[model samples]
Target: VITGARYPRLRRSGWICFGSWLAIAIWLAIVSPDGSSTKDARVKNCHVGGPEKYQRYVLGALLPEVDQFMLGFRLITSVDPLFTGEQASSLSNLTKTIYTDLESDPDFHALGSVMPGAYDELWARKFDHGHYFLYVPPGLDHKSPAPALVFLHGSGGNFKAYTWLLSRVADECGMVLISPSYGMGNWDSQGGVRAVEAALDDAGKDIPIDMNRIHLAGLSNGGLGVSRVAASDQGKRFRSLTFLSGVCDAAAIATDAFKKQWSGKPVLIITGTDDDRVPLNHVSSYASSMRDSGAGVEMSTYDGADHFLFFSHRDRCLEELSRWFTRQLAPALPSSKELKGQ
Candidate 1:
């Protein structure tokens, strides 16, 4: 747990602060000075900014970052449920799983959330006091173009949860990925959908995005959010919809507009058989609704996976998603004709 370089990085007070900032950066990534993994977004701006200008890369900070989990775990362990010794142990294991998944964060790493890497990750403001983070794929001499995947995370989750996966996955799939910090247990219908729409509109404005190839994916609670959004008038914007352990029955809480609007786009559903939290049965329930409504859908089931299958099997989950994106979202520069809308 020692984090000193034997000598200070600089003599100037400002630069010394900058060096300390680097330590903060490493610490924020959950890279233990003792032991941890480096499966996060590829980092180009490793050093902290200096005298010329000081800008903090606090994208994850505003939403879900390693630091939030670090603080949250301590809070979770001390909270109401884990009062007894046995319960504490179980809670400890659960927290450990969360840490493992975050350390191996798929979106940040897979999406290439860092500078001079493969892509650019940012945020777009929305009404209802909410905002959406953006992920734009890399460019060669500032002219490269690629497809995009807009993902939404479930309750008790934020953008950091997917940043690692998206960073790397974006590279492999040639897709830009974006997600917003909609808040835990609070799925703001209008806000969440608006954020996604804003991202798509922004991408379409420049760097070339295939409108026909646009797609939406969500997990757990977020699954419910996007599904509802897709079932609305705006849903037609995407070529397909993916529900991964989501609460597809958005009308119960969020909105019924989703039911009224039938993008009729292709659908892909994945559920973990052993998910104790949401259960594979829930997704099946949605499939029943879709089938009853004559909404075409395809489904896949994972064995021995938990409610957090996306985090538990990030590499595999993202690989499957990348393949799906490739089929659904044609690369922008490849052909405007390929875009169903363009």
Candidate 2:
């Protein structure tokens, strides 16, 4: 048993265990240090033996014993770097520059280049009703296609906010990150849907983006807004969603449309047990709805996080976000039709 449990029921079967590790391996691939995806890049080969070995295991065995490998490495390696003000400041600066340029571009491309050696491209998208801030990878300038990640800001949040977090992510995974600034109405169900649908339309034409891998993520009010949008028009274009410090109860959002649009997609809900505004009850309600509806749902509760879960626990939230997204977006599995998910 990975946990060395005394009860046999605590142990997972070989197939389930392998599947779990495969999930972790995908997580690692997404979060690996710079250059981790380059063919033969050797900085972190934590995928059991190697990608080759894992591939062989998956092909031959009912399930390759991947869980033990993932569990073993995760247990020993400190996944997050030590917290430091200097690193945070640098990251903050890098992110701000990315968002700042998107809204008001001056062609000073060096803004996103702060994360040296990573490929990047910036765009100012037209939303018809308004304009949006966007970014994508120019990928080694090498004809390779890439997937897209759209970021939604919470209530009182804007496009530039996640610049820091998303920039780090973009560098780590070579992903295209689009952070759409929602001026004042981001939380409004109608407005939320408009911003997301526009962002998706913007990315679709601007880059060689893989439509199948699109994901929605937000913290606080933005999270709730995303749930509503995912339920309505945007659901058809997306595969899954992530909610941080928010949920889908209409009573919570003060809207009936959102209440009705709650359960059409695979959802990942994250909340701090200490959250005062939304509380664990709301999170439980939302998660229960998805699960009871047979949607591929997941939730995680941190012991002392609050309404601003992302600010207090950036590393953990981002880690889980990447982990959950990798599991849902990776190319290994057949798409789930259970929820007719977006």
Candidate 3:
């Protein structure tokens, strides 16, 4: 019986295995160094710039995958010249500058070249329930009933990260910038809405704010969150809303109450056509839907821009936002009697 053996011979190619191992080694060399993970390398090479760079590096190191996906880079490659202790001190000093020093500094232009605003002062405080960051424009005081902009930070960002940009906006628009943190680096958790309410109220106590001109603003996750909040009964408190790189879920606002509450209220949605995180088509469709729902909707787009469009188009955004807020809220200048009453 010349029947072949039931077992078949197996073939293994050392060359193929060696090639695979070589490719893996190359990838590791490119993405990592000295046996450390890419994340560790990024942290070791972290660089802190102004608020934007601080937000990028710190958030990248802490939330690598999410930050990379949104910001479009791991923000790490070459080694950082800063030592561990130096980096720690640098981060601390930056935090103090953004969150503590600027707040307490009586000089109006405390940020100097970092942000524009002559005589504009920044302040931050942690209340019993939430954290509040306020930017008071030049000449603003208990008597100046300035328009208030309640800013919400995106995921992996805090009031400190946005203080430079939003404070500048507040200065340009002649408004008070009020940024509140929900204790954590998030705005979609329980008590989130209440926390915002509390922060705004607390800020009102410190400075005269035009309740009728109060507006909600945010970018990315903050944008979506403000949209959701503005559609609720709680949103009636604000005069209008501005969303950057954010989209409102049509399904969530399908109800008539949401539409009715937002009806006649203006909403400005700014997005980039090339945003992968929040696709352009999605933002367009949401704006259309909101318009149909009787909300005064305005959409602005930056061509060939992605999720981080704000970094490049910030000046344009500020201009558009100021115009939109002025047009929708119509916050007239308070007279001497009004200021005194306030």
The TM-score leader among the candidates is 1
Per-candidate TM-scores read: 0.62, 0.55, 0.60
Model 1 stretches with alpha carbons more than 4 Å out? 1-64, 77-130, 139-145, 188-190, 250-264, 330-342
lDDT of 2 by residue, 89-153 (tens): 44445444444544243222112111110001112222123333355443423245566677776
For candidate 3, the clash count comes to 3
lDDT for 131 in candidate 2 is: 33
Best by lDDT: 3
lDDT of 3 by residue, 1-342 (tens): 423452232123566678897786566444421211132111111111111221221222233222232232223212333224433343344444444434343232222121101001122323123445566766555586778888876654443446555656676677888776443234555556776777788777767998878899887777756866776667888877788897564665566866878888888889988777789988888888888888888888888767656655667877787777667656468899999998
lDDT against the true structure, each candidate: 0.56, 0.53, 0.59
Residue 24 lDDT in candidate 2:
76
Ranking by lDDT: 3, 1, 2
Off by over 4 Å in 2: 1-129, 137-142, 249-265, 333-342
Which residue ranges in model 3 land beyond 4 Å of their true spot?
1-129, 183-185, 331-342
lDDT minimum window of 10 residues, candidate 3: 41-50
Better of 2 and 3 by lDDT: 3
Question: RMSD in Å for candidate 2, one decimal?
Answer: 21.6
At residue 181, candidate 2 shows an lDDT of 51
